[model samples]
Target: MEVMEIIKDAFVFPSKDMKTLLIYVLLSLVAAGFSFFGTVVYVLGFVNPECFMWGGMAVIISLLIGWVMYGYLISVIKSGIEQSDEVPGFEWWENFITGFNNFIVTIVYFVIPAFITVIVGYMTNVYGNAMIVAQEIYLQATYSYMGSSSAIAFDAIYQALVNLLFSLTITITVAVVVFVIFSFLQTMAEARLANTGSLSEALNVFEAAKDIRRIGIGKVIILVLLVIIIVAVIEMIFSALFSIIPILSILSIIIAPYLAFFAQRAVGLLYSDIA
Candidate 1:
């Protein structure tokens, strides 16, 4: 019921507050700063191959910085909602502390999921490639013999069907796994916001994800489809606009990191209201 409430709250009215938009923009800038620095380090490392020793360090540091910024932004959003006001006079030092807390939470949430994802991806790629290669070889061998085009055609069709099924299975499997993890994180963070203390309480909130899905799966599906359509149109428009002015295109890359956080915050706000 609370999950349904959250979905309804988030979906009924979708306009973003100007203040929240500004917060997202600011956060985007912060994230981009770290990303740019990381990119520079990456390029420099490759240019000077001996600089590879520091490459991992740079990546680790970049991830830490980015994580902290994201956490801080989320904390600020939570705080803002609690205070019933916009991030009460934006103190950078305070944000740093909040960000660090968020960064830690993020790593805890992601470690297992990332490992699982890598394993699944590796297995899927290996299997998928092997299937395709086997099919290709079979087709070649059949082609070289007895002029039996019909048999070869049937074999090709069978292989295609098998490959498609395998691909679909792998894709759907991964998607479901990742989405579940994401839903768990969303529920936890939003609950923590709702009950203003207890990280453990936040973790407990994820137990309700099944109920949330049960009640709101249709709505969630619709919302996802709508978002995809809207984003597609927006992307097309932006793409055309960028074609006219190349500089504007660069801004999209800069805003990319904030997009995920902003979307998450928006969804959380909607769900929290429902809860």
Candidate 2:
């Protein structure tokens, strides 16, 4: 139940069956390969529009594979919630459905934050320009009143630029805060969805809040921080080790599923205490 123990157990959970882990890695490779293929086609398609269709197909295939990967992560969380010691077996259709459910849950959770971010962005990029126009107008009036031709109004332009910079800084800060808060909530929501097999259950903010309360906000934060730190360190190691061999470097993608599995398992373990 301790945060550290949960993290350690989560890390170990992925490797409990190397065969299952390899399946995850192989799926990741397929997804990555298709994604890469799509990118290349898109780039080449810029010169030959006919190639775009192939790129589109690649993208669609990649998305399906990615959905499977995501769904499997949900299963990991479910397994953790159930306190199951064994790895989950793959059910392709079920995984796809779960993955789609997760996508819907994710969109519902973040829609408001995304909308707010867009509004702030519009205000900063569009309405924020009004200040510059007002500044220019003020400068023109001042020049006319002085009985002289209007100049570039360098000082006014400078002040407007400074105001835009200030607005930009504020916008970025708000976006960051919104993303973090919603992302935290979404994580809890995903765990709930995984355990209950109900989309509505996951979307119930009040229910998720109850779980958070039961789990202790401090413990959740600690779990998140530890997982992030561990993933970062592991990623760095993978990058270093893989870079040693150019062709073998692509093997680093294998770690992606491992890290994802570990993190979700941690979330599941956190819920097991209450769920």
In TM-score terms, which candidate is top? 2
Clashes of each: 3, 0
With a 3 Å backbone cut-off (N, CA, C), the pairs that clash in candidate 1 are 5-274, 6-271, 72-99
lDDT of 2 by residue, 79-118 (tens): 9999899989888999998988898988888896888888
Best prediction by lDDT: 2
Task: Tell me which residue pairs clash in candidate 2.
Answer: none
Model 2 vs truth, CA RMSD: 4.0
What is candidate 1's lDDT per residue for 1-275, written digit by digit as tens? 24344334333222334454455566556555656665676678778865554655655665655654555555534632342323333345655555555555556566656666667766666466557767766876676686656665767667766766776578568867885756555544543533354445444435446535643656554544454454567578888999999989876853443344344444444344334
Q: Which 10-residue window in model 2 sums to the lowest lDDT?
A: 149-158
Off by over 4 Å in 1: 1-50, 79-83, 88-198, 208-235, 250-265
- lDDT values for all models: 0.54, 0.85
